[model samples]
Target chain A: MTLQIAGGLLIIAATTLIGWDFSARGARRVRDLTELKKSLILLKSQIDYSIYTLPQAFSHISPRVAAPFDEFYAKLAKDVEGGADAASAWVSAVHSLKNSNLDKTDLENFAILGMSLGAMDSGVQINSIDMVITNIDDSLKRLLAENPKNSRMYRGLGIVAGLLITIVLI
Target chain B: MDITVVFQIAAVGILVAVLNQVLKGAGRDDQATMTTLAGLIVVLFWIISYVSDLFGTVQSLFQL
Candidate 1:
């Protein structure tokens, strides 16, 4: 009986934690998207006011932004420093990044942020920012609609599942 | 054979139902459904032995 109780507690803890994690993924994505928006706006302002290049601008802005984005932006800056072109550096950074919640559309949109950077004039650069921001907005809307629902569902599922499993095993 | 098992099942049912309703109010319909199902299954499993024993007693009483 003691062993069964211990097993039940363990199942409950593990399943609840796993379900919470599933829910957190959605929250993480939301955070990343909002942070991306913030960082991009910062990048645009920095570029508009100064003669700073992409690397310097990214390096300047990376420190102030949140994680995953900060790391990815720093890597992009380093890549540019290492002589990779802006596009390649951005692509490599996006591809090499691990532990991010951003999906393929996000990665593609970020790639768009890079593709046109330094390859065009200031007007076009602003346009690229606008484009990525637009994409982020669209994603945010869909994510907001779907993720909270899923997150809550997953949490409830987790606890109930653990209880059921415990009863079955005992 | 423990009578406490029945109480435990009832407790789980009550808790799960409350949780399901809370989750639903919070806009988590999927989780609510899952919690309800889990509560049902767990209660069913907990009572399966007693139920079978009940059937056995009835069968003997009827001499079937």
Candidate 2:
């Protein structure tokens, strides 16, 4: 009887954790998007004010952003300094990101932003950054609208699912 | 037969009803329907052996 109870508890705990994890993803994505926007805005200011080359600008801004992105920018700076072109360096840095909260669409948008980074004039580069910022804004709005309902539903679902599994097993 | 099976089925029905409401409230009507269907299937799986046993008894009584 004790063994059965322990097993049931284990099952409940696992399923509940899974549900919580799934729901938490939306909020994490929101944080990641916000950070990306902040970093890009900083990049824009770097471009507008300083005459630093792309690598120098990235290295300077890398420390200012949050983790994952700080590492992302730092890697981009290193790659650019290592003689990789801006576009490829950006793509590689983006691809190298591990366990990032940003989803596929966000990553794809960032990759597209890379294509215009160093290949174009400063005016075009700033415009591209502006475009990405706008995209992040739209995504943030949608996520904020959807997150509450999703979080509640998933949390409830998780607990109820755990209970159901426990009942079935017991 | 264990009476606990009936209680388990009732518990499942309640949980599934709550889950269905949650999914529907979240604007996931398709998922709500799917959850209801899945719950029904799970209950059926639990009771299927008893259902077969009942049929067997009836067949033996009727000598059919």
Candidate 2 Cα RMSD after full superposition onto the native fold (Å):
1.5
The estimated TM-scores of all candidates read: 0.70, 0.94
Residue range B1-64, candidate 1, lDDT tens digits:
8877876776677678767776887776896898688778868876888899999999999999
Best by DockQ: 2
- What's the true lDDT of residue A151 in model 2? 91
Please list the residue runs of candidate 2 whose C-alpha ends up more than 4 Å from where it truly belongs after superposition.
Answer: none
Q: Report per-candidate DockQ.
A: 0.18, 0.88
Clashing pairs in 1: none
Best by TM-score: 2
Give the local distance difference test score of model 1: 0.84
